[model samples]
Target: MAITSANQLELLQTAEAVAREKMIEPELVIEAMEDSLARAAKSRYGAEMDIRVAIDRKNGNATFTRVRTVVDEELLENYQAEFTADQAKPYFEPQKNAQNIWLRDGAPVEDFAAGPQIGDVFQEQVPPVELGRIAAQSAKQVILQRVREAERDRQYEEFKDRAGSIINGIVKREEYGNIIVDIGRGEAILRRNEKIGRESYRPNDRIRAYVKDVRRETRGPQIFLSRTDPQFMAELFKMEVPEIYDGVIEIKAVARDPGSRAKIGVISYDNSIDPVGACVGMRGSRVQAVVGELQGEKIDIIPWSEDQATFLVNALQPAEVSKVVVDEDAPRIEVVVPEEQLSLAIGRRGQNVRLASQLTGLDIDILTEEEESRRRQAEFNARTQLFMDSLDLDEFFAQLLVAEGFTNLEEVAYIEQDELLSIDGVDEATAEELQARARDVIEAANREALENARGLGAEDSLIEFEGLTPQMVEALAKDGVKTLEDFATCADWELAGGWTTVDGQRVKDEGLLEPHGISLEEAQDMVMTARVMLGWVDPDELAAAAAADAAEDGDAAADAAPAEDGARTEEAGA
Candidate 1:
């Protein structure tokens, strides 16, 4: 009866209870409790003494002991457990030393048997005593701490692999505007910013969110949940749409204005399956389920395309696309739509186009047909006027040049005389006169440019520079880039050409160097040469000057012709 009363069944029951509550293994809890009791035992028996406690798994019985392992005296790595012959004489039976046998002391001994080889384990029983209240309380605290750490580690391991998965959780409580979620085994946090706009949660309400990330902290693993993330919608669709889960349909990209509207680009690997139709489900049931989960977020299941132009057309859904002008260099696309559909294409506050841009990964500039036409005409007029001013050509002749696909004076200055003669209402004599007049106009323009450049206070250093022409000097002076130092600070775009910002969109660039056909490399060389001239760079005058001389010769040739189209073409024909 006494043994039954002290069986400690309550301790075994408590370990089982805690294990169930903490969602951990019962054996782990029992081990933690045993280690805790051993630690508490050390406080009483002195820490230097080896003390251990083991709890019986079948019954509630407990055993206490001190463990010592016999190791070779020469092996100090386990010196605490190791013992020499004299130290362990009380434990080991000694035998007489054989002839030629030497003891560790290098002296003859009565017994020098090869005793206490490495790793000879030995245990001593210790009397079990009733622990005081203070000791019991300390043991309890150690057990709780160890169990709590083990629980945290278990939860981290469980959920860490499930990151990026859609998880269902219940609202536990709100802490500082963040919702604490009870996700079965562990807790998760849905931060305020990660919540969908205008969506609220009540205590004990079941909700679903994306497991955005999981981070192990000193306290526990922080499982971050999000309802507003773009992936959240994607995961919801993956849950409702079998095609996506089955790999028949692939979600290429997702963009969400969270709760307001969202778009998903879907493509099908299997030609037989319609990705958009599969995502929409029977009578839109699939997408509708996702929308409901998102608190009525409008969903647009766009068909994705491998071609960028086709994909962009699908991205801006519910609005018809008339034309798309893609600028590969600028990573931009201009969409021309019906005038009536502009507002819808752009959406309320530009939300539609903004989402489309995110989904397509391209800058979208939506314009009306009339706007594109007006822009084209404006460009034509600018070119026509430039020709009239620079080549002494009449409006009719300039318009004729522009009509023939001539954008700059260089095109006109270098074409074959026969190409000019081939034009309607133009004879060989007229062509010759036109070429001579064009040459004369450029030469006069050059002389006038020298006077204007000097009048505009161009630096004498720049004026005497071996490679700079009068026309280039005039351009530099006109643009407030006169001195070599001034030129060094300008970017390639500023020297060559770049777009102007309009309504946060880039418009056409009208830099002066564009008309002269200054290339990007040539602009860079110009800046480097200026740096050399100011002695800001190492003396590369020979190399820089040589490159600069080539640029100058190009400019000189450009100035000599100036719409004198037949100058170079005749040589090519010859």
Candidate 2:
């Protein structure tokens, strides 16, 4: 009996010790203690009995009890859980009544209700005894399981919001090329692919990595970390450089080649503060610290400019840039470097140019000064010859047109007469003649294209549709979309995307429409117009159907305009 009482006290003391070890609240541990004890009691008692255990939080005192509830003999439906056959046996005879607690005359018996009132809880103290070995093991298992669950929940809550921040941990071990770090409260995994290629770590070595994700799994919360991520290097700079931390200098963008090289584009908000000098610190002390942490990765700090061309030149550092021709529409840049600097601009294996593209967010094509000059000459000759052939102009007149930025017949035909006449070597008579010839050639070309497309079995409805270019109609015919009905039945993706498959399976039919350089909404509008022309749907009906579909798909905001021209064209996302 003394041993049994000592075991009861040990239960509460064990819970407190486990709670402190697991860094959980003592209250949670006590709850575990009660649950484990109750499980052991249930094993000793019958499975159907109401057995419960409660541990006092203030002391180690425990209460073991068998719980029952009071019930009204007159009301059987509400007292099902608490009512038992033995309690009602007193009222039942050899043949039980409809209400088991009622007398044979169908009247309720009042004898059983005086002891315990209806809807009252009744608990009976249980005697102390030695729990069987199996039941004791069962209690320990329950306590461990509950404690583990609570610990997992706490760890998840602790690291959920720490993603994207830099974290420090000690390298505990490595398995299958992945490093496992022992963070203060939990473990983090840095996969082999996330580590810098030129670096290595030994056991107990401290390291810093970016927290990429914290995912809850069946076993526990997995903290995925990365060291080669561009954001990781950027965060390191944010820590080493005070200007960036205080928001005086903004790190516009970062591109890294892991331990080999990296580039950072920075911009200053204040006119007096120089972003590069501040990041470099006094005598390059700040940047050196960052570089040392990165395993001697070369760092290039470039000043960011709103003018993308200027920024690109700055990003391609250690290489001189002579000229930059920007195509804003294509979002590409043609950079011309001196012959002596071509190899430097391109770098060894194109690393320099690659990083420049990432930093500026533009496609860069590097060209030598000589190659650029030759390309410019070729463009000039091509434009000059085009004008001479289309308008029957002499080389002198074509040269003037090309120099004035008139590259096409449409420009020459639609340009204001005054603007054309104001050109250096052009007079009003010459401009009028150029405009007449341009208009005549354009009309002739349109007639020929329509005739060609019609002969290819294109419907007059499609030929007359102004939205599609002549080439578009020709391409449609080759794809078996000649008639208006064929055009109306085409799906939006067939005309917009060339291919998008699912799980290595083709989602689109073979030989279907391919991308014609338009968005899906544009393709949809084309189909709608064909339907309206074929008399399959009235314009207003087509508009209503499109709006209804858009609203149903939760895309009404993109097509909010009334679908007067068939359905309103859906714009590409910003």
Candidate 3:
């Protein structure tokens, strides 16, 4: 048999073993022992039989006891008193019921129930014994679970704020094709897709990424991260550009063809400060920082303009613009570049112009000098035909008859048949044939001329001159703006804003003329046509000679009217 103190020391050693093996606290062993002993005693004796058990955490010492009631004749009935009523005969009853004491039944039984039988056993001291391995293991598991629960709560508090923030981490280890990054406070998952193209990773390599998500999984906290998102660029720039952070400059939009190039639109509230310059920073330091973050991808910081043409021209930077022909109705623009600059303007694989078009919200039609010229020629030919068709004569026959000394079709058609016959080529048969042909041509020409004078519906007032290409004509038509007269009537600055095509193609701006196929001379010609059609000019004084011509016509009309009046008066007088 183990002595009390020796058994206590052995219990302490067992608790320490359990604590180390299960990684649980030693104090829990003493607590479990005390609880088990108290429960055992309660099962062996009724719950009403008072019992107690205690265990010392330091020594693992345990004690168990039973509390007994002291009773006499009066006390046996109450189970709490020590005196009998016979000791105070006058004060209480000491009859038959008194010797019978309280029994389980409410009525007194025949059997004697004095406070206690001399042979009744009241309490027993149960000693601690070795617990089964499974019981010890189960207790250890419960303690460890509690410890882990506390540890998880601590970790969650540490990492939740870091979600969605950009972080730099060292590659810790990789598992199941996913890489784990040590983000100081916790581990973050670097998904395979988030790895930059052509970028390799190894243990201990430093990497930068945006925290995409943080979630609590069964094992622990999980953090998801990414590197390729465009917002990553925006966030980096905001860190670099003070104006953006201060809200003085706004980044309106960002677009990227990642790993290659990116375009950002910016606007500033203050007109004095350029938004592009502010974003670019001093000597390009601010933008360069963002570029470094992106691994050398080109960044174009374009100043956002209300005019689509101007915006596009800016978006296609490094390539000079000769002109911007805007078509507002169709949201398109044609960018004209000189023949030599065409390749530069279009860029490799046409990516430059294509991205520019997308960035500026315009359908860009890039035109070369030859294409522009052909386009202009076609437009001129159409207008010339329309103009000629409106004249009251068969255009070919009118020229022919005019060469033959008949100035107008009316004069040719009105000639006498005999007079026509008198001419060298005019036999009676030829004369009749020529005269008949003249009348038919005249009627057809007249009808066409009338139709030409009237135009096609409400878009009529805008007379697009024959000389301008469809690009130019379409641009002017969209402004509710008409001919050069209408265009020039407004100040040059007014037309400087953008315009679009009916089908949404952008007309190239005039500034692009040299770079496009048009020379300075052609630009001037188009500008002149634009100016003349719009009727813009410095105010010139009306000539004093205008009064003399009016006076002369007035006198001639007066003299003619009086002569007719005098003839009528003479007839009345007669």
Candidate 4:
């Protein structure tokens, strides 16, 4: 192919066709063509020379030019493309003469005295090259590669924002147990594990999936689709429920067992909406639509509550809860249900409680009412035994102390004397004697723990950290954290215990001080305090940072107040 005037328009027409087919901008295609033409020109001319091509957007006329840059004498390396400032005088002489001519003719003359300095560029028009077979083949490859890259870019930009949305696609093929779906303008992959159980598809079968993710890879944009995602069901409900679509009702949380049962917590902003009923729809139409799409997966649509206990109770629906005990520090809940409802509350193989745990973001232990009563009785007996042994009290006196909520010697030793006196048949003298005995037991236990910690190489720095108790120090020493520095280096989660995700399941990480009832926040404060005491962190700097954070929070709250007030005013007007 030759670069001739007759075929210049053909170049633009070909570029437009390729761009339309690739779904990319025509200008990008033209830029690619210009690059390919420049490469061909470089081959025809000297490869060391800087050759560039520009196609006029209006007429598609190709212009080839050789570019040389003026550089410092020491920096000039490429002879054909770069020249020292001293060697550029010849190129600037003509421009200087042109300026004089303009000045003599009373025409405006811009300054040209400091002409052709370093870093200045010079361009000269060059004859167009005739493309030989080899050069033409190379140019074709360049254009194709560039077009493919632009197509990939277009696909990535199109789908990146569509993540977390539902998309409809036709099944294209199956590769290694992964379903390839033809989402218009691109392809997406639905992994085998992301599909609902036993959901098989043949080529050309239409499928709806959640756009779980869009990642840019070397080959192309990877769009990950999922049918078993919890969000998929929530999205289906949003599609079928007008109230959810309109924001009058919101799906707060969703937990799915894929092909089995699922639970979704919903809340209504409008008092009259009844989010659960709205999602269920008339005659179960709305929920049935979702269930059918999920392959007959039963869904429990429960009302969302700010109180986690209430929400958990609702999440374990069709199973009556007798009582709820929440352990906030551990973030676990114990739900007591009647003996008959125990099986239903736990579901088949604990599925109900598992879904409730996921929905409420807490670990749930479901026990029958009888089991709960026994556990409480055991705890009461244990406390009574401790009081009897530590305070030297009789069985009735120990039972009285346990019933009054004195669980340990520490509480009895530190509590107000009036509290013990308030117990039935307890006088001031009896209370005093009980407190004295309780203090002696607690002190003796502390001394014993300190002795053991010291035996285990516990240092005075750790023992005197103030926030940590003697037992906590002993535990730390047993765990090899025998110094204040070691304690400071420990993470808050390591000090208070936390759950970690392992193999898609949460596993408990036991903490050294967890048995001592140290909360995560308290552990953090103690660690930071230790760091400050050891001079690892400056307390003044910490104070300044905290003040700055408080100021930013105050500013943000102040900024939000006006917007909230305006919204309220608008609502009142409405």
Please provide TM-scores, in order, for all candidate models, with all chains considered together. 0.62, 0.71, 0.41, 0.90
TM-score, model 2 to reference = 0.71
The number of residue pairs in model 4 that clash at the backbone is 0
Q: Which 10-residue window in model 3 sums to the lowest lDDT?
A: 564-573
* Model 1 ranges with Cα > 4 A deviation: 1-11, 56-130, 374-574
Candidate with more favorable, higher lDDT: 3 or 4? 4
lDDT of 4 by residue, 335-389 (tens): 9999999999998988989998899888888899889999999999999988877
Off by over 4 Å in 4: 95-110, 532-574
* Ranked by lDDT, top first: 4, 1, 2, 3
What's model 2's lDDT at 28? 86
Per-residue lDDT over 263-366 for candidate 2, one digit per residue giving the tens place of the 0 to 100 score? 88887777777778878877778888888877778888888776766778888877988988976333247999999999999887888898888787777899
lDDT for each residue of candidate 3 in 379-476, tens digit (9 for 90 to 100): 55554453245444345533444445553445656887776565554478766666666677767754553344333221343444554443343444
Indicate the residue-level lDDT of 365 in model 4.
87
Give candidate 3's TM-score.
Answer: 0.41
Flag regions of model 2 displaced more than 4 Å.
1-11, 34-56, 59-131, 392-394, 424-433, 440-470, 473-574
Clashing residue pairs, candidate 2? none
Task: In angstroms, give how far residue 27 of model 1 lies from its true place.
Answer: 1.9
Q: Model 1 misses residue 539 by how many Å? A: 31
User: In lDDT terms, how accurate is model 4?
Assistant: 0.85
Error of 3 at 185 (Å): 2.7
